[model samples]
Target chain A: MLIKIKWILFVTVFFMMGISEQADPLPSWNNTNTKRNIINYVENAVNEKSPYYIPEEDRIATFDNDGTLVPEKPLIQILFSIEKVKEMAESDKSLLEKQPFKAIVTGDNEYLKTANEDEVISLTLKTLTNISERQLREEVKDFVFKTTYPHLNKTIDKIVYKPQIELIKYLQKNKFKVYICSGGTVDFMRGMSKELYGIDSENVIGSSNKYSYNEATGEMILEPELNSYNDGREKAANIALIIGKAPVISVGNVGAGGDIYMLRYSQNGNKNYKTLQVLINHDDDKREFKYGEKNNISLNWADKYKWNVVSMKNDWKEIF
Target chain B: MLIKIKWILFVTVFFMMGISEQADPLPSWNNTNTKRNIINYVENAVNEKSPYYIPEEDRIATFDNDGTLVPEKPLIQILFSIEKVKEMAESDKSLLEKQPFKAIVTGDNEYLKTANEDEVISLTLKTLTNISERQLREEVKDFVFKTTYPHLNKTIDKIVYKPQIELIKYLQKNKFKVYICSGGTVDFMRGMSKELYGIDSENVIGSSNKYSYNEATGEMILEPELNSYNDGREKAANIALIIGKAPVISVGNVGAGGDIYMLRYSQNGNKNYKTLQVLINHDDDKREFKYGEKNNISLNWADKYKWNVVSMKNDWKEIF
Candidate 1:
């Protein structure tokens, strides 16, 4: 009887050690404060007796797609628009007579660099629409799967920051429903969301064009109208209008003023769960890439709010 | 040994019968094709062996709030809007000088009775905005909880169509995520969705005003601008934009052209799980109200599509 009890204790201890060895949710992340903060937050969030415990229904975590999830110096959506414009110009040469369309088709974006909101919108409509949403999505699908990134020499899907994807899955495993809230078009991001990030189309939120559906064919056609161009304040506002609840974990990067408002929205006066704000800082040009916004607005918000900033060089042990 | 085996078999049969006896999901509906169709669709949807099996992630069900889920003679939202307008006038007598506001203040809606779309929108902006979304939601909450129905002699919450609530719960029991797609403002419906219909705020979708957030306070202030006024074809269009997936089951009513497009949106060329379209016909004037659209558009669509039309008096054995 004594021998059996001792053998049972030995096996249990070995089993626990084996389980812990395989339980690193973010293996790609270095043993830095960034990784520790995320794991600790999730652990406390799922603990029923913890003050930071969030009910499963309220555990929403939103992520910014470009810059945060993948490379954004040349946004994937921008490349998609360029290819679409080139396709349109091939059929109708008159499209090349315009400023932005001509600039895009001829590979000169000097005019686009200084374009105002209205000028940019005109280009978006010319390139992104005058077709059904289904067709636009198909075009994007082809581009993402076929095209290779310039410097990375790999497809966008194969190189979506390994650490971010792991973080999303980790949150999902702990009962958090993750959403992609980006400045990219809804259908544009949706084209690659499922296969790339394991997020379904239903959970992806972004800017979209107003649609007209055919009763006979049931295809939703995109019109030359802006539905909502989400960035900065629109990001938080649209979340209020759509998701109806404030997210508890909001992740973005410090490239621009892209995600400061969303992070603020998540942390603003939230008394339930201890909200987490993660700002990914690109600091490794050797491994991946490095850049910053024109202004220090995003970094300022991160500083004032005491947000966790993950340095790519120090915090990410791997880069896809 | 044979006698003991026979006793065990008898007990097993009795246990199977007890499970079936407790498995009636929709008890408020009388035996009819309406109830039968819903049960059949759910059964096949959840059964993996069936060709009509919808993967759990794709089991989205959207419900139109007015006339479909609850009463709509004097829509709950309309009543709430009127009360807000009145309160606004009482606070600032200057607001009573306008045409619609003046008419409303004097208890004479002569001007509003034939007001055009822009004029109605002007009123919507005035009553629904110039305040934070949170403040407007609080106002709606107060109105829904305190107001009494005119002829029903019961508060709206106390009488929300018991059969419809049962149907919602039944679908939820089978792993369907239900959402409220209503012409009412998202904030307006969100206020009472949980208490009255058992739907969370995040599951409610509706028209909304644009919002601007106060960086200091984090309050999302509603702007006078209309973000998306969802009605007619816009309902389906907005759903496609917001929800990103076409609903397999869409429920609406025939009171007006309020839901024909959404019903069509659900069934249009869907080759997946057998899509179900339900049109609740408010035929019982003694029990509920009776009404129809100006034209036969809704009923004609229902007839052409062979959508299930629930007769409020005949199909419902009970109403809340």
Candidate 2:
């Protein structure tokens, strides 16, 4: 009778605790307005009685990748290209004879800081990476696994913000279709999307390279040309074209005004459901890198639009 | 006691019948090798012990629209553009004065028959369609639900091939990710894909028009210019560039050499799983339209490649 009474008491206590406690959807987030706002928005969205109620199909979320999801300190794609350019220089020798390639090969760091997209494309296509996508994807996967960002000790995949990932999962749990809208090449991002962001390759929209298909071998050769450069206004346009739906929630970081258009596009006042727009303000140099565009256009836009600005120092309890 | 005995016997018989019977996946498809091949391939693919086992991530299946799913006749997109052109001409009066618009508006049947894509673009952009994608998509949905194809009394959505739809659903039931790599406009197709083929807007890859984003309102205005014309060789390239994974199963119809490249692309011998390539042949004039490319390019290629040539007359028990 004593043993049975003890077991009953334990079961009752456990049941009461289970019923009393509401689990945190975003545990990595600190108890700030940024966290509170996100939680409140999601709660209202899933509640049919709430005015902010969003149906499953309308819960579209678009996230910018490079700085928002991972550290973009000088952009990760450029680093990937630079590594390939150096490897090619050892064999070709003629690569060092070119302008952008020469700058990269000779360690002209000052020149590279101001290198244009055309120069970067030339470095990528002319020196390396115009082969079949299957082959290039293998190389990208190898690089991502082996790579460490400058001043960072962790592998590329581990550099993602813990709070942002929690937010993505929270939104997904409420039936949101989350898409990564990045300015990086779609081919490059697709190689790591499944592993890095828990996002499928098809759900990632990015800058694309024109491809040439070989009818005989059925090999898809990545052409030496830009099909679409997914950035700024183009990001929003690509979302409209590919996804064919306006995102109710958008997350981006401050950089070269790259995300302003996409953020503005999301909050464009067409939505029947209440929306959330998160701008990650990289102000914590101790935990993560501290940087923004020199012009401050994106931050200004975020301010003007009243989008939620997440301070890395205040909003996150942990940064991966 | 007699009633109880009868109930027991009935239950035993029903249990025996349920255990003995296996469901037919593609009922619209007659007992042919094509159906057998599809079933066998998917069975082996999902079976972990089989050599053809494909993981969920790698179970990619791509399908073509147009004649593959719905009748391409004069091409449904062209007909849609014609309808818009006619509507605009009625209000403006000046729209009937242009070259291709005049050709369409004046009912110059010969000119329209020979009208190329540029002429079609001129007719579409000049007369109409330089509006927001949201508004344009609404018009497309209205057309799909209300309008009928030429000589077909049914609405556009009702005219989809039942056998193909059955095949798509069968693939889905076996954990395959099915995508529609159509030559239609992505915006136009997104409007009716769910109703017509049970495809989501994001899963339908197609020809795209350049779009301009409205920063103030987030309205994506459909530009008059062509972005990517997803047909022929481009179909295969677009599949690679967008989906980023080689399809293990591809379904397309013979019209031009359009389906040939995509079919070949699917069977490129790069996968671990056994693949299925289906070439739909429109050789039943009595039940449906009978047509093939004049050059016989697609049929000859299918013969050379030894792909499954599904004769519309012999293979299908039903058309729609």
Candidate 3:
């Protein structure tokens, strides 16, 4: 009887201990080698006893916003600018006669579709300028809240990757200061970054337009001049300028060519800094559309640099 | 006896409570109206029941670095630039033939003194350009630690106003995020901001030179182009771009006319924001040299705007 009681007690204690010890940090991630590697790296970096431990103040993580955090096939800013132009054309019919404005407002999807990425960006900027900073923010808020992602059949806020969201939380919980280093305008992302990813507006570093304070009107107005194009090597430069530190972790999707420099910069940080470069490969055709052969640059760079590639089909258990 | 014991206990508890409640937040400040008002404003700002209560995240405070934080008799950047130019002249003798380099290296202080502020600034830029970002930082660090204030006979780090330091601590304890918004270069200020003000490098926003990445050397080099001059209205613009919000409190010393726009911007923030503009009057000739009639712009603005004035002679118990 004594032996039977002791055996039952031992089994109960061990089971509870096992449950306590196996807490999932990244629940949305699958039980794969990639997930295990991420968990192991985080554990070592956060462990005080480990030689790879980074102090909390120095634990900076930067993520590319559009493709990495949310779906960008129909880019957020492009949609936002188109809607804004349409709204403005309602009041002033003559604006539709302009070059970029006409392209966006005339239901002339062909003009925008046939144009290169730079032309599309120019069209967006033309639509966004000539407004007070306050008005721009209000317009973006309205669009972000009301619009839906066509393919996903969900709201823009609901379209963020479940695994990436989990990763952000995991990094934040480990005392890392997470920043959104994006190619979009700072004012555009400032509207919904906090709502979508728990990122503060100040931590969102991005491209900017020339903004001047009007002494007569006491208003901050946005001008058409492009102050910065925060892409390619400029992303790293802006990170150094704004954040004033080398990030320990850089996360981005593979489709864009911009995030390569940022990732390489992170890898080449201080020798004592143990860095991680996570490139998300959109390979799950059934879930998220696969960009096959479109990410050759990122793939080649990853192969050369030995960067960790997170396959959407294999690593992520679910994609929103 | 029981009644007597109860009365003694009540008196003892009340005495201890009095001591705790009366602890001065700014001990380095004198018992003047300015000191009293500062305490009262902070108390109300932090009080949850008060209409002026600001949330911790929104409690941002910006301070000018030059005259406000450290003495800027010979502007901190000018002194730093001169020393850097002198050091560079040692390696490259050809640099001595340059306009600013000749003036600084030959100790022709008259050129800097006689020249207008803008001309002096132009000279400084000429001397500071064309160096790697790493080299600039290394040079700034060497100069900051070794240099001393001529008048005060103390190292630059030791010359920061004691009362201002106390005020910073008081504001920080009340959960205000302090930032140094200076007219100096971002790279130069980033070197010692952490040591001097307990401010992180990220929180130090300042003027910047255009920078480019060298692919071959893997270096970020400073180009000769002026990226942004963070002074006057430009200060407010940079604050909006970098900080992404208006500061609740703006503190600057009355010597130069640069801080006027920043103070006005803080005051013109959200209607319900409850902002405070503090202008430190350099009126103490005994402890610190008096800038008598030179700060007319700031003085006039403060008078018209009803900004709080911290009189150095009457308000502060110590200067350095």
Candidate 4:
């Protein structure tokens, strides 16, 4: 009996020590004042006895995926989608004769870039609709697993910033519900978010295509109809419609239409709602490409609004 | 001297009495329970002295315009946009012969309803592009000022619920910056949001069209290209990009996507943003058309997400 009790005590102590010694996934994060400030703020709000202690229900966090998590210097997703379109065109030679697909296959990036948003959308729809939903999901899964960022030479999924992932885990550990609020396609993101970010499909809100359930077939069918682009204030509306809760914390990189709406929804006065707006400024070029306020409308708006801009150059101690 | 002193005292007493006579905006709100709970939560998060108090830089707020602020029953904007299309088609006889324009000119509500989302969008683009941006803005403005809701018989803008408007004012009074985050067209909302909701053009975030600046002519031209539709998680991105801050509070109605993203963004561990996700559920058939989870995705998502559903059946003492 004495030996058993001693052994139990030793095991407990070892476990506790092991847990304490576990390194943060983002160890490169400098022990800077900014990091300390953020940690302190979280601690205060989470302490139940503290006046600032917020209940778990109010602890909601949102993060943008592009540029914020994954690199988007040369329009990463667009490139990938275009590549997928090319592959589809190659498989089905009929698509090779189409206007947009023809342009794409010929390596006419300039013409594709110059195409209006609607034209590009139409092309995307035509290309994406070539496959069934199940097939598309499988294809996306395969692509995500194998595809690597050309510049980083890392698997696209692995290109996510370690610090941001840590931030997400930390928030989740503190009972804050985290969501990936992105501009990417809803189905596409839904397919990968759980595996990539540990966020469930229901929690991952995004742009959607109109879908219908065929009563006779008893199968969900994707319609070639654009319902609404998840951008700008629509982003806010989608948030309200889907999340059904005002968030206390919001984070994003780009100042596109969606980010603005998220901030508006998060900050608008109502009962029991609080928010922290953060813009992840991409200023690191060594690890990631850097672009600021040249033609990026969202980035320009962030500066003009004097938001709490987190400089990748200064604030973050580590890149992806 | 005695007469003067008496007069002064009487005047002072009268003023004090007058001040006390003023009614509280929300007098029926239970002071020490639900109402106080809300106020305390907001105060704690907003007050800089408190540990939970978010700095002013982080205090972002977003509001949805359609059914949330104005009447959406029958979709007034869609109707107006359709009307504008018809009017334009009158001059452009060629458009009258086109597939979508031909359909619009028929004025068959059933046919229009049967039209797919793509068909509706294509028709709208054709009609809208018939006129210049300036002309389109003027036409929409004129329609808004002149038209009244068929059921309410009140000017469409006046159909705004007085209580919600008061809430907007209340938020502004408390130093919270507000924005109109809607799924409506950005230009259309920008034309009227300032006058109707006291939200500025810069603060209005919504679905948008790609525009071009004619440097040679010194004119900004609206292109027919649809850029991004502001919906779902995109709403969250818009908030972050435009507002450059996360909100401590978010107010939305059924169909507004702002709530989902707002709630998620509000729960950042670093920011400790609190959220009051209020859903303005329309259930009064007498004042406004009742709309909820009957057949709409918004209502369905709201129910599934367990949002703070504010039913018109229970919460509101009055409707516009």
Model 3: CA > 4 A from native: A1-22, A108-120, A216-218, A292-295, B1-22, B111-121, B215-218, B292-295
DockQ each candidate and list the results.
Answer: 0.68, 0.62, 0.51, 0.02
Total clashes in model 1, counting residue pairs 3 or more apart in sequence or in different chains: 0
Model 3 residue B154 lDDT score: 85
Per-residue lDDT over B1-320 for candidate 2, one digit per residue giving the tens place of the 0 to 100 score: 99999999999999877764445778898998988887888888999999888889889899888889888765677778888878888898986677667877777767644554445445555544568878877888889888887777888878889999998888888888899988777787787887777777778888777989987766888787888888888888888877777798988888866778888888883455578889999998887798878899888888898889999999999998
DockQ of candidate 4 is: 0.02
Candidate number with the higher lDDT (2 or 4): 2
lDDT of every model, 2 decimals: 0.82, 0.81, 0.80, 0.62
TM-score for the A-chain in each candidate structure: 0.91, 0.91, 0.89, 0.82
Sorted by DockQ (best first), the order is 1, 2, 3, 4
| Backbone clashes in model 3, listed as residue pairs | none
Tens digits of per-residue lDDT for model 3, A1-320: 99999999999999987875456777788888888877888888899999889998788999998778887666778777777778889999999788678867766766533443355357556777777776777777777878987677887878889888889988888988999998888888888887778887778898888888765555567889888888888888888788777788999778767788888877874446788989988788898777734558888988898889999899988887
> Could you give the candidate ranking by TM-score, starting with the highest?
2, 1, 3, 4
Model 1 chain A — which ten-residue stretch has the worst lDDT? A112-121
Q: How much is B129 displaced in model 2, in angstroms? A: 3.1
lDDT of 1 by residue, B1-320 (tens): 99999999999999988876556678899889888899999999999999899999889999998888888766677667677789888889998888667777787644434333344445678787778777777777777778897678887677698999999998898899999998877888888898888898878888778888776887788788888777778889888887777899999988768788898988982545589999998889888887776787888988989999899889999978
User: What would the TM-score be for candidate 2 when compared with the true structure?
Assistant: 0.92
Candidate 4 Cα misplacement greater than 4 A, ranges: A1-28, A91-94, A109-123, A130-132, A255-258, A269-273, A295-306, B1-320
TM-score against native, each model: 0.92, 0.92, 0.91, 0.47
Name the best candidate (by lDDT): 1
Question: How does residue A129 of candidate 3 score in lDDT?
Answer: 79
lDDT per residue (tens digit) for residues A1-320 in model 1: 99999999999999998887556889899988888888999999999998888999899999998778998756777767777788888999998898667778888756434333344345577667667776766667777888987678888777799999999989999999899998888888888898899998778888877788887888788888888887888898878888887899999987768789999999982545689999988889998788777888888889999899989999999977
Highest DockQ model number: 1
